[model samples]
Target: LAAGCRTERATSVCLLRVFSVCVCHPEEKKSVPSDEPFRVVFRNFQRTLARPVLLGQGEAGAARGTLQVSRHQDHPEVCVYVDASSTLPFVPPKTCAFLGPLFPPLFSPIASFLPSESHGVVLILDGIIQCTERDEFAYQEMISFLPLCCHPNPQRVLIVGGGDDGVAREVAKHPAVLEVHQVEIDERVVELSKQYLPFMACGFESPKLKLTIGDGFEYMKQHEGAFDVIITDSSDPIGPAESLFRESYFELVKRALKPNGIICSQGGSFWLDAGHVRETLDYCRKHFPRVTYGLAAVPSYPTGQIGFFIASLNPETEFREPARQFEDAEIDQLGLRYYTTDVHRAAFTLPRFAAKALNP
Candidate 1:
């Protein structure tokens, strides 16, 4: 398929074919090998449908391929079809296959509804699973509350690249947060989340939220010392989010934060890439006086886990211990599913191997 190709869905099966030109941007053209293979995922099987329909025209349509649908005995509702001769380089393990088209040249956002055992629905961008409804709270709560609770007073908050709005939802739950400003480069992710994943998208409806669709780096440059807390809910260090993990981005974040400000970002999973995690922390330490790495169990993410890089401008700031602890009743009142004062402390306590790799 081309870089930004769209797949059309039928009653039960989705038709995805390669094209010479990008669907989202017609001005760009991508060349594909004739024998290149693409995988197809079929889920929510209600009834048998017609065979896969081939799309596109010319050599792109006539590309040589074979489709084989394999169903597991445990999960009869889901089936995966792949071209036997080729390997799927993009699809992640345990993630539902996407049927939507890629959006924008920089980011390919795909949303898929999975079987009940896996999750309800997921938002995937650039072949990485961003959020699943079942376990999204685990990530959203930790990323938002970790920094908010670490800060003594986090009134004005800024969220960078949280297009799904999950971070906004969790940030708004903090009573100390008076205003929430979010900047997302891609508007399609927000619109798609609102349409397919309202549970997270509802965060956009919060009265305290003031969203600005723009580049977070540029946005932060213009708003120096404006926010008490800044959370960067970005993807891995690749594609459109690659710059988010750089030293320059941390410099911008430091400039945008107040004197005592605290910030947290979506640090890559150590299990997947420890060096990248350490590199990100090094960048953070250069800008902030105190920096800590926290982990969360997000089943849908790679390795069934994800980590966050939390830093504070105050030299004495303790990220492991929450500055503001919420009572059990207060936690219930805030509709918190995964975060607690104790959990906040435990998240920063890394395992032996992780501590050695990250701290060293």
Candidate 2:
């Protein structure tokens, strides 16, 4: 409201560029305590487009004023709707825009009630990247790499639901990985990241990589026991991703890997989504012989914390070693901004509360 103006349907830079925004009107909701700011949202329900500038957030309401910015929208100035009674609170219109073209009603109001961190950015420490710190690549790295390294030789790896390509890029680093099959349900996420996040999306260009645009569940059902290591890098348990956290899906994952096969998947935040994390761990324990919960610090993710579950049939194999290629001098030569061995080792370290919630 400061310098940026909102329009009804006309597209604007900040509106059409990203997905959603979180604005707090603390006093609007009676349930909110006096000390808490009222959380509101401005959602953009349109096609995902890349632009130089995404959002222009500022202080509008004067009473205990709070200013927050969502990730980014691709369209021009558009209507910013409000919905206060939500688990995550604010959801922009085109959050799952990639799925929109295929399933038009995927973002219905009922579906909007669930929590999803993928469509928009969670505001942390004044809009810095620390939002993902809680769930770092450290924990994700352990869950992803440890299993792949345990195998005598891992050549074919399959990753389901890792649209961000972060997990794909990490898996491709293993020299034993001669080929990678990354199956994602949404293609816009891949295409958008290709424009927005270059480093993370670099995995899409690897010669060893084969990208598939389809349902990962169906993909797994068809390719039973075909992978040395299979990783599920999916969003939190909400919308279409909830099935990824279920026992049925883990059952499929169990069958998707070779005898010595291993599987790893994001279990949500150990702090905010601790209950969900425990449920996932419990489900994984039922399907796999070895189930371990690991933590990471991704600055962009909420609460500076994230968890991953590793399921393997091998009980004799150690769980902490890095893959050989990860240690190779030549492979190590690549300029990495986030992942490291010490970081990888430390990612498994969880706070007492988190440990108790997931393991207890």
Report clash pairs, candidate 1.
Answer: none
Global fold similarity of model 1 (TM-score):
0.73
Clashes of 1: 0
Each prediction's RMSD over C-alphas, in Å, is 12.1, 11.1
Weakest 10 consecutive residues, lDDT, candidate 1? 53-62
**What do the candidate models score in CA lDDT, each in turn?**
0.70, 0.55
TM-scores, each model vs. reference: 0.73, 0.65
Query: Tens digit of lDDT per residue, candidate 1, span 1-360?
Result: 211112232113233443211112112232223232343233422211221221111111122343322211233232333342344323233433444554553364333333232355655443334666679999999999999999998999999988889999999999999999999987877887788789999999999999998899889989999999999998767546788889998999999999999989998677656777899899988888899899999765645678999999999998877899999999999999999999998998888999999884
What would the per-residue lDDT of candidate 2 be over residues 94-149, giving only the tens digit for each residue?
33222112223322121111112342422121112221222334544555666676
Query: In candidate 1, how many Å is residue 202 off?
Result: 0.4
lDDT score of model 1? 0.70
